[model samples]
Target: MRHTGADARTTLQKGFHEPVEKPKRFYKTVETTPVDGGFGVLLDGRNLRTPGGVRLVLPTAALAEEIAGEWRAQGETIEMADMHATRLANTATGAVPNSREATAGQVMDYAASDLLLYFAEEPQALVERQTEQWGAVLLRAEEEARLSFVRAAGIIHQRQPEESLERVRQIALGLDDFGLAGLAFGAALFGSSILAIAVQRSWITAEQAFELSRLDEAFQQEQWGVDAEAAERTDRLRSEAAALERWFKALRT
Candidate 1:
């Protein structure tokens, strides 16, 4: 009988599967308060947006600028025509996008999130990539959902619709919690999409996402000699993200 070491290890590794819970980290839930009878970002009882109504959450300057740049190059607001999964502000549910490119705010939000998170976790030297991506649009369209929530909230406060059906669109704290869980579980294998949504939606910190990504990359690199730990971690994180997406999907279904 010939036995390979790999087979033995595989069998042994499966034996360690225990009924344990995963730890949740990288979040600091402040609080929520009502603004004009709607939800507002809060730190305990204080309103995040006050006086002028700008969000109190830390803004990612590079992100906001990149989206603005795209608009400048295009001569007007822009949006993807074939954005299948990219749910824009009103496009997702069949409403005009503020008489603009029809539905680009969310796209900008998605792209901005990409810039913010990349710069956030990235070293200062390599953080200038947004300048190059200004005229380019290369991101998963589905991620625009994050921006939808942010914009929806702003619009909610502004319009104060009699019905306010848009409230149904709000992503709950649980989704944020789930996204964070998935990121930590990946421990570096976390996808940019998840992190992008988080920051754009103002859930987790960009610094945390960047740091986790670096650690995950480092962990995987260390295993290159004999194993693909990074790949393994990524696979697991993918599963988690899929689960979070599923939860959200189920609600819509």
Candidate 2:
């Protein structure tokens, strides 16, 4: 007899005999080749295309190989979410090309509420941790981007200097579409334009940038027990950070 949806799930959870759906193996092999301007990926001997149906021609051969490697690493079921490198390349090649200015503007907008600009209050330890970890990154931004960011002692809102904002905007405008995409990812992941710029400039590695971003949360987690939901969110952010790091490394090669 057939069971209801919940009943079937309960039965499966109870370890009753049931057939499990196996993952589908879509492609047998993946390869890469040099295209006219960049490189493309071939899945089972046919060139792969983006979701938008455009031929996936990445700007660098290294990037192409990274994307191809993602495809080749797929298990029986091809999970698009697992293909972070390919998705990032698709954004760089397709999305960013048509919206470079907008993307740069988005990254620049993060400067308004950049994580480094906000500070914790009360506890001296947390405050000092923020100062020690985030302050150095801010100094690096001032030196590298020539943009001086104002800091707040607490949650009070503060307006950054107009000239500083414009200077930061100009720096963002200077980056190419590929660079802008990576910067946007890094900035959004860490919620700090300064950390993102530092990552782009090699002032700090992605792992260090993440650790800096989560300093306050890490402090609180140590004081209190960890929350499963918060841990999951941190894991996802770390994964995104690593993906952006790989993309940037590919661009450098």
Candidate 3:
């Protein structure tokens, strides 16, 4: 059986929750072709299309190859969740273009309540670690983006400067659809807009972002030992972060 771009998009939207009924691989060849915009993927001589039925054209040759590689890796059956590049490409080509403004707004929202802005007041050691790690990243975002942020000690909300948030909004608006999609994914995944931007800007690796985001959980695990469920969750998140990082790298190459 063959899969359509719409099928791929649906699988991505559902994520790993619902089990996808894998389809038998039908294409004998997966190759990259030069499209007018950049590069395109061809399977058995037919051009790949997006969920919206638009020709799937990537912005870079490297990215095209990455998506093609996913298709090439399929065995007797195709598993949509495993094709990270294709899922992201489906989003960029079909979903993101239509929701660009909404996507940018979501990123700005993440910046407003970024995880890095809050610190634990009770634990001195956690405070010191967060100050040392998250603080550094937040400071870099302010320095580089020319923005100001307010930190909170506990659950009470501290409003960031309006000027700073507007700057972040502008920064989000500046990205193209694909870039915005990547930014939104990273921000939501890491639960910190500053950390996401750090990874997006090449200031930090995906692994560092995961480590910084999981600081509280890691601290708890160290003290009380790890829960089986939490560890599994962390592993899944780590893999997704790495996949997003790979997608970003491919776009730049």
**Each candidate: how many clashes?**
2, 1, 0
Leading candidate by lDDT: 3
Model 1 root mean square deviation, Cα atoms: 22.6
lDDT of 3 by residue, 90-184 (tens): 88889888888888777777777777887889689999999999888888887898867998887677778888878877877787777777887
Residues 1-253 of candidate 2: C-alpha lDDT, one tens digit per residue: 1111122223223522355554576788889998887788999988888778888877788988989888888887776666788877777777988887788776677777677788888599999888888888888788767889788876667788877767767777787767777887777777777778888888888888888878877888999979997787677667777887888888888
Q: After superposition, how far is residue 217 of candidate 3 from its true place, in Å?
A: 0.8
Model 3, residue 105: distance off in Å is 0.3
- Model 3 misplacement above 4 A: 1-15
- Which parts of model 2 have CA positions greater than 4 angstroms off? 1-25
Candidate 2 Cα lDDT to native = 0.76
Best by TM-score: 3
* Whole-model Cα lDDT of every candidate shown, in order: 0.31, 0.76, 0.80
Query: Quick one: how many clashes does candidate 2 have?
Result: 1
TM-score of every candidate: 0.25, 0.87, 0.91
- What lDDT score goes with residue 203 in model 3? 90
Give per-residue lDDT, candidate 2, residue 23: 56
Residue 128 lDDT (model 1): 36
**Candidate 1 off by > 4 Å:** 1-227
Report the C-alpha displacement of residue 253, candidate 1, in angstroms: 1.6
